[model samples]
Target chain A: MDVDRLHRRRRRWKERLMTVLIYLSVLVALLPLFSILIYVAIKGIGALNWDFFVRLPGPVGDPHAGMANAIVGTLELLLVAAAVGLPIGILAGIYLAEFGGHGLFSNSVRFLADVLSGVPSIVIGIFAYALMVLPVKHFSGWSGGVALGIMMIPVVTRTTEELIRMVPRSLREAGLALGVPRWRVTVSIVLRTAAGGLTTGAMLALARVAGETAPLLFTAFGNRYWHRSLNEPVAALTLQIYQYAISAFEDWQRQAWGAAFVLIIMVLILNILARLGTRSKFSTQQE
Target chain B: MSSSATGIPGQGHHPPAGRTGSGGTGEQPGGPLAAGGLQFSSRPRRGLADALFKAVTGAFASLILVLVLLLVLELVRSSWPSLKAFGWRFLVTQTWDPVRQQFGALPFIFGTVVSSLLALILSVPVSLGIAIYLAEMAPHWLRGPVSFLVELLAAIPSVIYGLWGIFVLVPLVRQLEVFLGTYLGFIPLFSGPPYGIGMLAAGIILAIMITPTIAAVSRDVILAVPNSQREASLALGATRWETIRNVVLEYAQSGIIGAIILGLGRALGETMAVTMVIGNRPEISASLFSFATSLTSVIANEFNESGGALHISALVELGLVLFLVTIVLNSLARFLVWQVQQRNGGAARV
Candidate 1:
C-alpha cells in the first residue's frame, strides 16, 4: 500500500512538472511576438495623426509628412501582381489536381513547384531586375509586381492543388457518369467544392507577398512622391518601413514604426479572413 | 454569395448515373454508348483545350524552374569577367573598392558562415527543448493557441524583426558585451569593443526568428510518435521522461533533426533583418562583435551603390552561393524526412 502511494505521488509530481515546462515553452515562443506588437502599436499610434496620413514624405523637420506614396504604391503593386499571377496560378492548380496522370511530365512539374516554393524572394527580385530593369534603365512598379507575382504563383498553385485534391473523386465520377465532359466535371464539381479554399489560398499568398522587402528594394527601388505610373519607381509599406527604420533621422524612425504597425495589422486582418474562409469551407463540407 | 450557393454555369453536380466503373475496363463492354461518349464527340475541342491547359500550366511551372536556373546562369555570366580577372584570388582577397572597380568576397563569405553557424548553435537546443515540452507536456487546451502564436512569429515581416533588433535587442546586447569584454577580455573573440550591431547580434536575432519554425516542425514530428511506444516503455518500468528520451524521441529524432536543418536554411536565406542588424562592414574577422557584411547583406547594401560590371558580377556570385546553399539544405531536409517516413513504414510492417 505504501509503495503504491509513493508511486502515485511521484507520477503526479511528474505530471505537474510537465505542465510547468509546457507553459514555460509557450511563454518563450509567445514573448517575442507580443513584444514586437506592443512596441509597434504604442510607438506607431502617436504618429498616425491627420496630416501624417494626407502628406507625402518630405524634407527634414517636416512633421506633417506621411507615407501616402507608399500606401498607394503597395496597393497598385499588389493589384498588378494579382492580375498577372492569379489566373496562371489557378489554371496551373486546376491542371495539376484534375488532369495530372502519373507521368514523367507531371512528376517534373511537381518537382518544379516544390523548387519554386523554396527559392528565396531576393533571387526573384534579382532575376526581375536583370530581365526588366537593366533593359529599361529604370526602376518601376511593373518590375516589382512581376517579381512578387512570380513568388505568389508557386504558393497559390500548391495550395489550390491541395484544396482541389481534397474534393472527393466521387463528385467527378458522378458527373462523368451523367455524361458530363471532363472539363465540365472539373469546373462544376471539383472547383465549386474547393472555391472557399482557393480564395483562402490566394489571400494567404497575398499576405506573404505583401511583407516582402528585398524583392521590392531591387525591383521597385523607392519613391519619395505619390506617383501613379507603373513605369515610375514606387514605394511600398515594407520598403518604407525599411528606409525609415534604417535612416539616421529620428522622424523617419517614428514613421517606420507607424508603417510597421499598419503592415502588421493588414496582415493579421488578411490572416483572419483566410481562417474564416477555411473554417466556413470545412463546416460546409461537414454539413 | 447566391452564385456560390448554386454554383456558376458549369459548377453543379449532376445526379449519379447509377453505374459504377468497377469491372474489367474504364470503357463499357456494351455497344450503345461504349466507344467514346459525349466527351469523345468534342474530342478535338477537348483536345485543344487540354493542350492549352497543359501548355499554360507547364509554362507557369517551367517559368519558376527556369527562373532558378536563369539565376544561376545569369550569376555565372555576370561573374565570368570578374572570375577571369581575379582567378583564384576572389575567394581569398578581402579588398572591395568600387572607385577602382576592385572587389573580393572573402569577408562577406566569412561573415555569412559565422553568423549562420552562430544562429544554428543558439537556436537548435532551445527549439528542441520547446518542441519536447509542447509535444509531450502541453495540455490539449493550450496546444493550439501556443502553436498558433508560434506560427504568428513566422508571419511577422523580417523588417519588423530588424526594427526591433535595432531599437531593442542591440542596446541589451551592448550591456552584455561590455560585461563579457570586461570579464573575458583574454579571449580573442571578446577582445574588441562591441558595436552591438554585428555578427553576434544578427545571429541572436536570427535564432529568435528561426526558433518558431524549428519548434513547430519538431513538435509536429514528436507528436506523431505513436502512443503505443510510450505505453510499452512505461509498462516496462520506464518513467515518462525516460519513455520520451528512450522511445518517443528516438522514434522522432530524424524528423526533429530535419526540422532543425530547415530552420538553418531559413537562417541562411534571411535577408532584411540580418542586413539591418549586422552592421554592414566588409572585412573578415574572428570576433563576432565586430562589424561584418554577409553575402546577401553585401549584395543588398551595395548592389545599387556599387556601379560597374565586375562589382555587379561579384554580388550576383554571392547570390549564387546563397542559392546553392539553400538548394543543398532543402534537398537534404527532404531526404531526411523521406528516410524517417520510410523508417516508420518499416516499423509498421514489422
Candidate 2:
C-alpha cells in the first residue's frame, strides 16, 4: 500500500514536471521570433527618414542614400506579377473547383500545383532566366515579374480552389436550376460569392513573393539607377537589402535594415488583413 | 423561362422537361416562325459556348502541369553540358575552381544536407513540445493567440530572417561556439575556430525559420488524433504524459515525420537566410563552426558573375540537384500527410 502511494506521488510529480517543460518549450520556440522582430525594429527605426522614401540610392560611399528606385521598382514588378498571375490562377482554380470531374486530369493539375509550389524559388529564377532572359539576352523587370508570378501561381490556385470549394453545392445547383449556362452561373454566382476569400488568398500569395530575393537575383539583375521600362533591369526591395547587407560599408548595412523593416511591415500588414478578411467572411457565413 | 425551349438533347443541359416540352411543343410549334428559327440557331451556339468554356478552362488548368514539365525539361537541358562534361564525377568531386574551369557538387551537397539535418535535429524537439502544448495542454483562450504568433513566424520573409541572422544570431552563435569549444573541444565537431558566420549559424537560423511549419503541422496532426484515444488511455490508468507519449504521439508519428520532412525541404532550398550567415566557403569541414556553402546559396552567390556557358551550366546543374532533392522530400511529405488524413477519414482541418 505504501509503495503504491509512493508510485502515485512520483507519477504526479513527473506529470507536473512535463507540464512545466511544455510551457517552457513554447517560450523557447517563440523566443527567436520576438527577438528578431524587436531587434530589427530597434535597428531599423533609426534609419528611417522622409528621404528614405523619396530619394534614390546614392553611390556606395555616399551618406543619406535611400532606396526610392527599389521601392518603385518593387511595386512595378508586383503589379506586373499580379496582372499576369491572378487571372490565370483564378481561372485554373475555377476549373478545379467547378468543372473538375474528379478525374485523372484535374488530379494531375492539383498535384503539379503542389509540386511547383515546393520547387525552390531560385530554381524558378533559373527557369525564368532560361525561358525569358535567354531569349531576350537581357535580365529585365519582365523576367523578374514572370519569375515571381510563377511562384505566386500555386498558392493562388490552391487557395482559390479551396475557397470556391467551400461555397455550398446548393448555390451552384440553384444557379443551374435557374436555366443559366454553367459558365455563367460559375462566373456570376459562385465566383462573386467567393471573391472575398479569393482576394485574401491572392494577397497572401503576393505577400510571399514580395520578399523573394533569390528569384529576382538572376531575373531582375538589380539596377542601381531608376529604371523606366519593363525591358530594363529593375531594383527591388529584397535585392537592395541583400546587396546592402552584404556590402562592407556600415551605412549600407543600416539601409539594409531599413529595407527589411519596410518589407516586414508590408508582409505583416498583408497577413493580418488577410486573416481579418477570412475571419469576417467566415463568421458572416456561419451566421 | 421560355429559354428552356431551345434545350438540345445529349448536351448535358438539364432544362426542366415540363417547361421545355410545354414551351416547345404547345406554344412554339406554329407560333412566330421567326422566333422558332432564332431559337433553333441559338441552341447550337449555346452548345458551342458550353464546349468552348470547358475547353478554355481545361486548357488553363493544364498550364500548371505544362509549366512543371517545362521546368524539369529546361533544367535538364540547361545543365546537360555540365552533366556531359563531368558525368558522374561532377557529383563526387569536391573541386570548384572557375579559373581552372573545374566544378563539382559534393561540398555544396554535403553542406546542404548537414545544415538541414542539423536544423531538423535542433528544431523537432521544440516543435513537438509546442505542438503538444497547443494541441493537448493549452486552455482554449490561449490556443488561438499562441498559434497565431507561431504562424506569424512563417509569414516573416526569409530575407528578413537573413538580416536578423547576420546582425543578431551570428554573434550569439559565435559566443556559444566558443563556450562549446572550450568544454567539448575534444569532439571533432566542436574543434574549429568559431567564425561567427558558418554552418552552425545557418542551421540555427534555419531552425528558427522552419520551426513554425513543423510546429503548425504537428499541432494539426496531434489535434486530429481522436479524443477517444486519450480517454481510453486515461481509463487504462495511464498518466496524462503517458497518454500523450504513448497514445497521441504514437498515433501522429507519421504526420510529425511528414512535417519534419517538409521542414527539411524548406531548409534545403532556403537561400537568403543561409547565404547571409553561411560564410559561403565552398569546402567540406569537420567542424560546425567552419564555413560552408549550399546548392541554392552557391547559385545565388555566383549566377550573376558567371562568365561563360560552362560556369552557368554548372550552376544550373546545382539547381537541378537542389530541385530533385526538394521534390522528392516534398512528395514524401505529401504522401505522409495524405495517409494521416485518410486514417482520420477526412481532411485534418489544418
Candidate 3:
C-alpha cells in the first residue's frame, strides 16, 4: 500500500511539473505576439487621428500624413477578391463534398487543391505578376485581388468541403426523393445545412487575404494617392507597412507600427467573427 | 456589403433539411407523409433557368480547379526561361552578381535547407514536450485557452513576426552571440563575426514561428490514441509515464513526425521574417553564426530590384526550389497521416 502511495505521489509530481512546463511554453509563445502588439499600440496611439485616416501617405520620411489610400485600397482589393472568389470557392467545396467520390478527375482535382494549399503566397504573387502585370504593362489592384483570390480558393474549398460533408446524407437523399434534381438537392439541402461553416470559412479566407503583402508587392504595386481605379497601382496597409518599415527613416517606421496595429486589429475582429460564426451554430448542433 | 448580404441570402434561404430529414419516416420524402400524389409531384422546372443554374454551378466549381492548374502551368512556363538558360548549373553555382548578369542559387538553397533543418532540430523537442503536456497532463479547463493562444500565434502575420525579430529578438540574439562566443569560441560555429542577424538567429526565430504547427498537430494525434492502450499498460503494473512512453507516444509517433515535417515546410517557405533577420548576405557558410540568405528571403528581398534576364530567372528558380521542397514535405506529412489512419484501422480489426 505504501509503495503504491509513493508511486501515485511520484506520478502526481510529474504531472504537476509537466503542467508548469506547458504553461511556460504557452507563455513563451505569447511573448513575441504580446511584444509586437504592445510596441505597435504604444507607438501608434499618438498617430491615431481622423486626418491620418483621410490623407495620403506622406513622402518617405513623413509620418503625420495619413494612410487613407492604403486603408481604402485594402478594402477595395478584399471586396473585389471576395466578389471573384467566394462563389467559386463555395461551389468547388460543394462539388468536392457532394459530387466528388472515387472518380479519377475528382481525385486529381483534390490533389491539385492540396498542392495549391501548400504553395507559398509569394509564388502566387509572382505568377500573377508574370501573367497579368507584365502583359498589362502596369500593376493593377485587380491583379492583386486575383492573386488573393487564388490563395483564398484552396482554403475556402477545404473548409467548405469539410463542413458540407458534416451535413447528414439523409437530407440529400430526402431532397432527391422529392423529385428534386441532383443539383437542387446539393444547392438547397447540403449547402443550407452547412451555411454557417461556409460563411466562417469564407470570412477566415478573406481575413487572410486582407493581410497579405507578398502578392501585392508585385501585383498592385502600391499607391500613394487615392485614384479609385482597380487598373491603377493601389496602396494597401500591408504593402505600405512593408515598404515604409524597410526604409531608412524613423518617422516612416513609426507609421509602419501604426499600420501594423490597424492590420492586427482588423484581423482580430475578423477572427472573433469567424469564431462566433463557427462556434454558435456548431455548439447547437453538438447539443 | 449590402449587395453581398442580398446575394448570400439567396444562397442561404433554404429549409432546415439535415436535422429534420433524420426525424422523418425512413420511407417518406419528408415527415408526416404528405402522401397525396399532388405533394409527391415534381414542379415543372423553368427549364432554361434550371439548366442555366446547373451550368453556372458546374462552371464555378471547375473554375477553381482550372485556376489551380493554370497557376502550376504558369509557374512551370515562367520558370522555364531561366531553367533552360542556366540548366542544372543554377543549383550549383553561387555567383549572383546581377551587374554582370551572372546569377546562381547555391547560397540561397544552402541557407534555406540549413536554416529549415536547424529550426526543425531546435523546435521538435520543445514542441513535443508541450504537446505531451497539453495532451496528457493539462487540466481540462486550461486546454482550450492554451490551444487558442497557439492558434493565434499562427494568425499573427509573417510581417509582424519580421518586425518583432528586428526590433526585439535581434538585439537579444546579438547579446547571446557575444556570450556564446565568449564560452564556446573554440567551436568553429561560435567563432563568427558577432553580427546578430545570422543564420542561427533566423533559425531560432523560425523555430519559434513553426512551433505552433508542430505542437497543435501533435497534440491532436496524441489525443487520438485509444484509452484502451493506456488501460492495458496500467493493467500491466506500468507507471503512467511508462504507459505514455510505451503506448501513447508509440501510437502518435508517425503523426508527430508528420507534424514536424509540416513545421519544417513552414520554416522553409517563411520569407519576411528571414528577410528581416538573416542579414541578407548571399553567401554559403559552414558556421551557424555566419550571415546567409534563404531562397524565399532572397526572392522577397531582391526580386523587385532584380532587373535583366538572368536575375529574374534566378529568383524564379529559387521559388521553384522552395515550391518543390514544400510539395515533398506536404506529401510526406499526408503519407504519414494516412499510415496512422491505417494503423488505427488495422488495430480495430485485430
TM-score, per-candidate, Cα-based: 0.89, 0.92, 0.88
Number of clashing residue pairs, candidate 3: 2
lDDT per residue for candidate 2 within B1-350, as digits (tens), equals 00000100011112221111112111221222324333433445555666677678778899998999999999999999999999999999999988888999999999999999999999999899999998898999998799889888888888888888988888999999999999998999998998889999999998988888788877877877888889999999999999999999999899789879988998999999999999999999999999999998999999989978898999999999889988899889867855664676644433
Each candidate's lDDT (Cα)?
A: 0.75, 0.83, 0.75
Candidate number with the higher TM-score (2 or 3): 2
lDDT of predicted model 3? 0.75
Residue A243 in candidate 1, Cα distance off native in Å: 1.3
Best by TM-score: 2
| Cα RMSD to the true fold for all candidates | 6.1, 7.8, 5.9
Q: Write the per-residue lDDT of candidate 3 for residues B1-350, one digit (tens) a residue.
A: 00111011111112233223222112223554435543345444533444555456557777767876777677777778888878889899989888987778889889988998999888887788777777887788887776767666777777777777777788898999999999998898888878888898899889888887788777766776777888999899776677778899998889788878878878888887788789889888777888999888878877777787678877887788878878898778756745664565422211
Candidate 3 at residue A244, lDDT?
A: 72
Name the lDDT value of residue B231 in candidate 3. 91
* Cα lDDT, model 2, residue A33: 85
What docking grade does candidate 3 earn?
acceptable
Arranged by DockQ, best first = 2, 1, 3
The top-ranked prediction according to DockQ is: 2
Looking at model 2, residue A120 earns an lDDT score of 88
Candidate 3 segments whose C-alpha is farther than 4 A from its true place: A1-23, A60-63, B1-55, B345-350
